[model samples]
Target: MSKPLFAILLGLSATGALAQTVPPPQIQVTATGIAKTSPDRVTVAYQVRGEGTTSDEATAKARDSAKAIRTGAEGLLRGDMELHASDFDIAPVRSRECNRDGYGQAQLSTGPCAILGYVVTMPVSIDTPRIADAGTLAGLIGRLGGLQVGVRGYWLSDDRPARQQAMRTALASAKAQAQLIAEGSGARLGRLLRVDDGTNRDMAIVVTGARARVTPPPPPPPAAPPIQIDLSPAPIRTNVNVTVVYAIDQ
Candidate 1:
């Protein structure tokens, strides 16, 4: 054979050997696991809003109401009960007025617009392990004028254990799925090649049992009725997703 023909034959042989050394195929699968449990803690929120002709007056009024609430809440605080001020804000209140034109075309003009007054708001939060006292606290705050109450039900204080449990279940699920796929394709799963931690989402929902809004009536009743606060038991859901890649036996 000529030299050129011999060289071409050798190149084809090398290419065939390289092709025979290709790696086996891989299978990947993803799975999610969810765990739910009742929350172990409760939190209640209160707001005090004051409106006055001046910013200082409005802020002073708001501060007074907040102090009263803090004092009252202190009395209700037990070993597990916690009370603290969360937020405060003050802003000017605005009003708008319009008048018709002489041509009777109803062309309105800015009549009398000014900063009528100032408004102030303060927010307080209470966290307690004693779930039953939520109602009593709400009633107490309701009786105090210029205060609004909102209740938030159960939330897990710590989520580490729950997350670990979810991760274990997620891995098992992924393995099972990968095994199933391998069996369907008439092959056995060899070993784990890769792992990816997918989305891990945790959410807690607070069920509000009661909301109290006190508005002074023209002739307010001799006394306000007792406010009933109920916090239903709500569960927190923890979810974990994982993607696993396994090698296929040749």
Candidate 2:
């Protein structure tokens, strides 16, 4: 199920009012914390199109172009760089033969049919430990094709670690709030009832290519081992909400 925009759960005890025939006491509140860090990885995906008179020609051209990108990016991409054909299409470009009826599929004879080129795509993921070197990679990719430039996807580094740290801190803060609220009301808080993690999502930044989507190898000045997109650390977040019940020491 999709994560809710907000969540609230509460636990209470009847000892304070059940015997005396008074209403049970209840309370509610929410807490939040946010942190930011530089992204450690980037994902890039883009397409390459090639048109020819025949389907085979278009397909071949597209395949060839995609391969070229992969080759160019061989030494520039991270270890986990993925270079594969995303998609392909080969069809005739036709203007429907005018008929008495309105627009319909054009059943024209194959005399000099123009072929619509296939758009081949290549998607790549990079582990950018050195965030600063991104510009260098960009320059290399921008010139991958004659002139066509690709897109980029940048995300935080060591995401799981970051999120875990953030969640722990957030949860602690929440519990502190709960404890404070309970104490101010002269109630001794008991064990935690439950907790709900906040909305969880992965925002995938897109990456483009000069000719097609290309994940290049790490840059030449090999500062560290070939970068690998160990996605386990790319800025992931986990939220937690806990409900605690307190026994009123009457």
Candidate 3:
């Protein structure tokens, strides 16, 4: 037999009575802080590529290019500027030919595909605290030929200090606002109830416009002066926001 409607309502009322409660009054404030710091280092990456009918030939060409690049940047290799070269990678260039079968389906040749040539590639990186030298180095790499240059980033090596400063600023703002709200409502601000940290740590400064053609060209004449490209990197900015909840004593 089903229960009576009054009995069901009484049971529900009992359950609700057991779970009833009241929360204390509180004030919540969200504040943001921004801090800027000069970039202390810059990293640049460049690729050296060579193509030849044989693997050995391709490797030799790529090595030659790498040597040329090192020699060109020799002057900048000292005093906080360092170069890092990764291992070379060699891959085959392939070609395929196919014909139509009797069923009108495409059928590839039974034998192995022919290799047109081999390509060798080497990746090199430059790390320097002298941010102003980035542009000059890029120009030199472009003129040296057989390379494509890229800028990794302009960064602050250690951003903990900046993050701490921003957090302090945010906390101060949040506390001040909370106190103001409590006083205006005829209540005293009590202890801190909760704090939510919402700082974004994945900040990166990106730079572009440092690429060279794949085809290598002859070096310029002795009379021609080197090209200069100035890239003044802007300061790195860090922003942090925090949500704070404070108890109220009425």
Candidate 4:
């Protein structure tokens, strides 16, 4: 071969050898960690509904009832107890009547439709750390006329600590998994190239039980003890996912 051709061939062989000896890029591993904790707060929602012939009367009645409830709740407030009035709304109540023909068979006829009354509703929300008072509060609201009580599931007031702990665990898991993979492939795990927080955009999992609807029942027999309600909430879970990149040393 000529000198230039031989030089070119030699240069190509050297480049191929250099490429063959170079190590591959770092390995990336994704892992998830979860942490569970019990709820630390309880929230109860109440709605006061008033019905009257006129909208003004209905609104006044509802407002008065809501004010009374708020006053009572203020007295019940203790450490970490809070009361919030959410909404006040007024809407028309509708009623329909059926028209019958002389044969008594139902005929397609337009019946006299009119507004029966006006209904006003006031919504109130209460948050407290006292889980044991759920039963008493529910019963009290039931006894109060023109009030409907809705009990929401328990929740964690603060989840930052849990999330941080889960993130740590997820990172550790990713490192361990990467190490195992490296060892299996006859390589050693090197420095971390990158760590991506995959949980920042994901929402935490909050486990809640089915809501219970309770209306005041007839008075129990004198011999029967008063009823108690227990609303045990499920544990709240925080999950963290991480994508970790680590150098592989051969």
Candidate 5:
């Protein structure tokens, strides 16, 4: 080969060798951490429902039921306790004699499929910072004509502290995993280069066997004894995910 050709070949070989010897700039590890804690807040969900021959009548009945529930809940609310109405829906009620298709959609049959009435429903919730009052709230709301009254779940009013702790734990777990990987590959873990995190979110715990019994309404008599309910809920679990990048030292 000529001198110029030989020099070019030698330069290409050196470049390839250098590229092969260089290591990746960083190593990345993803980890998830979980923290379990007792709930600071208890939530009860109930619905006020009324059915009447006309829409206006149904709405009025629902309104009355809501007023009664509010009045009854007022005495139970302590500091940091709240009552909220989340949604309201009005739907037509049809006779039970209506025919149904395979999809469960109602079909007009030769028989009467006329609209029987209208039903109005409003979903309400009681959120209290005191966890012990969940059963009491459920009981009171049930007596106030609140249908489907039950403990919805247990939650944390403020999840910041739990999220922070979870993130720290996740970061530590990532570092440990990164170290293992680095050592296996004949490298050492270095400074943290970057972090991608899942933001703060609450994971509510579902309470089972905490439902309250429904009593026929007109509001219970004042002489009636208070209902006793026992509620045992599991701890809320918060999970945090993090992806961390660390510079690799060789």
Candidate 6:
């Protein structure tokens, strides 16, 4: 081919290649912000476990403990606070001959699970928004049934307010960041094109009940009422994520 014709063919090929490689959909940036705020409510789960040779015996024991827990907990939770049943379970004590962790050889109960003996457990949730004395309630729960006891965690009182504030803060920060980036790159930032709200699972701060043994039986001490240790909410950190879409100006 002539030199001129060859040059024209190469130019067309280059242009075709450039057109095929379209620029990526716009650049999108996301940012997150966290806000530390006072908790609005307090929630804690109290567990009571019981065991007996027969299913009826175990169930009765659990019922008694649950009634006691509810009695003590009813007035403790605030008006707006809610009460939810945790879980009920029955497990058998295993002998070494049967299994190391559980009684694998023992006759199974008439259920879907491998249950030997009856193990009844109940959990009561306490909301501290309206309750006046938290320490008092704790002491009351500590004395119930004298069995294994545990507390899950205390979450932020109200979740909505903190989440909203965090989202606003994150969006503002993202916009500022995007604008700066666009300006420095010789481009203009456009209107927001998208938004996303993130969910949160509270991370626990304190965990109780990990001891192998308990205090020895108390001597004949004063039969004073249970020990109540009132508590107040602590500062909680909440976070929010935001994605902002801005048109890229040429």
Best by TM-score: 4
Please list the residue runs of candidate 5 whose C-alpha ends up more than 4 Å from where it truly belongs after superposition: 1-26, 90-118, 183-186, 198-225
Which prediction has more favorable lDDT, 2 or 4?
Answer: 4
Model 2 lDDT, residue 30, Cα: 55
Please give the range of 10 consecutive residues that has the lowest summed lDDT in model 4: 217-226
Instruction: Report lDDT (Cα) of residue 178, candidate 3.
Output: 98
Residue-wise C-alpha lDDT for candidate 5, range 165-195, written one tens digit per residue? 7877999999999999999899888999988
Tens-digit lDDT track of model 6 for 91-192 = 665443345444445454344334456677776676655433555666666776524343344566556667777777898898888888888888878777
Instruction: Tell me each candidate's TM-score.
Output: 0.67, 0.57, 0.68, 0.71, 0.69, 0.60
Q: How do all the candidates rank in terms of TM-score, highest first? A: 4, 5, 3, 1, 6, 2
> Which consecutive 10 residues in model 5 have the weakest lDDT in total?
214-223
Q: Model 4 TM-score?
A: 0.71
Q: Please state every model's RMSD to the true fold in angstroms.
A: 9.6, 13.8, 10.5, 9.2, 8.5, 11.2
lDDT of 3 by residue, 1-250 (tens): 3679889998999988876755679999999977888899988889888889999999999888887776666544333467788678998765544222235454333444456689999889888787877887777777776366877789988887787778788899999999999999999999998888754455453456988635333433323345766787888997888999999998
A best-first ranking of the candidates according to their lDDT comes to 5, 3, 4, 1, 6, 2
Pairs of residues at least 3 apart in sequence or in different chains that clash in candidate 6: 41-157, 90-119, 135-228, 135-229, 135-230, 136-228, 190-247
Worst 10 residues of 1 by lDDT: 215-224
- Quote the positional error of residue 182 for candidate 3 in Å: 1.4
> In lDDT terms, which candidate is top?
5
Better of 2 and 5 by TM-score: 5
Which is the better candidate, 1 or 5, if ranked by TM-score?
5
TM-score of 5: 0.69
